[model samples]
Target: MNNFTTFFVSGWHHIVDINAYDHLLFVMTLCAAFKLKEWKQILVIITAFTVGHSITLVISSLGYIPDNPKIIDLLIPFTIMITAISNIRNYGKEGVFSNKNVKYVIALIFGLIHGLAFASNFKVMMFNDNIIKPLFAFNLGIEVGQLFIVAIFTLMLFAYSKILKGEHLKWNIFVSGAGFGIAATIFIGALS
Candidate 1:
C-alpha cells in the first residue's frame, strides 16, 4: 500500500478494531435512539462527534493535551454508560429528533475524550514531517469507520423495527442495556 493509504487504513482499523471496541460501542450508543428515517439527525450527531474528536486529536497531536490513557480509558466507557442511560431514561418521552442539541453536546464532549484515547496511539505512530496530510487522512478514516458502524446499526435497527412491528422501544432498551453492560465491564476493567 502507498504511504497515505497505509496511514488511512491504520486509522480505520484502529477505530473499528474488534478487540478494542470502546469507540464502536460509543458510536452504537450515540446512534441507537434514532430510526432509519432520522438519517439527517444522525448525520448531524455524527458530525458533532467527528468535529469534537478532530479538535482534540489535532490538539493532542500537537502536544497541547497530555496523553492520559488511564484516565481516558475510564472516561471512555463512562461516556458510553451516560449515553446508554440517557437513551433508557428518555426512550419514550423524546422523539428521535427531539433534544438534538443535548445529544450533540454529549457527543462532542464524549468525542473529545475519545480523541484523547486516539491520540495516545496516534502520537506514537505518526512519523511524517508534515502532520497535516496524515492527520487529515487519519481523521477521514475514523469518520469512515464511524459511518460504517452507523450504517450497520441503522440497518439492524430497521430490521428489528420491522420484526417487532412497532415495538421499537424494546429494541432501544435492548441496545441500551447491552451498551450499558459493555461499558460497565470496560469501566471496571480499566479500574483493575
Candidate 2:
C-alpha cells in the first residue's frame, strides 16, 4: 500500500501521520500537566501553538533557514520530549501548573520546533513560485486532521470524566513522554 493509503486507513493512523506521535504526545503531556477542561484555556493554548508553528513553518519555507529534512525530523520528537520534561519540572505537588505564562512560553518554543518538522515533510515537493499554494493546502490538511483528533480526544475525555469517572492524566504524560523519547531516538537513528 502507498504511504497515503496507510495513513488514511484509520483515524488513528491518520492522526499519527499528519500530526506525528511526538506532537500528539506533547499535547497529551500538556493536557496532563494542566488538566484543563475549560474551553478558554484550550483556546488560548491552541492559538499560541498554532501561531508559533505557523510562523516558523512559513519562515522555513520562505528560505529563512537551510532546510535539513533529517535534522528537522530528529528535532521534532526531541522538542516534544523536552516539552514533556519541562511540564514535569515546572510544577511540583502544587496542584497542576504553577503558571500559565510559563506553559505558553514553552508551547511557543515547541511549536516553532514543530513547524520545522512540518516543513521537513515538504522537502521533497518541487518548489517554485507557485509552491505556496500547494504548501498552504498541505498545511491546512494537517491542521484539519489535527483538529479532528483534538476534538475526538476532548469528547472522549468529557464522557469519561463525567460518566465513567476515569482520569489518568499524570500517567498519560509519563507514558507518552517516555514513549515519544524512545521513538524519536530510534527514528532519528534510522534516518542517520
Model 1 over residues 16-92: C-alpha lDDT tens digits? Answer: 89976888888888888877778998988988998898888788878899767789889989999989989888875
Give candidate 1's whole-model lDDT: 0.83
Mind giving the per-residue lDDT tens digits that candidate 2 earns over 74-184? Answer: 776676666666656654445344567666776777677777765654544534555555545554555565566567667766666667776645544555567567656
Please, what is the TM-score per model? Answer: 0.92, 0.67
Best by lDDT: 1
lDDT of 1 at 75: 94
Tell me model 2's lDDT, rounded to 2 decimals: 0.59
Candidates' RMSD to native:
2.1, 5.5
lDDT at 79 for candidate 2?
63
Backbone clashes counted, model 2: 0
Highest TM-score model number: 1
Give the poorly placed runs of model 2, Cα more than 4 Å off.
1-19, 91-97, 120-138, 167-192
- Estimate every model's Cα lDDT from 0 to 1: 0.83, 0.59
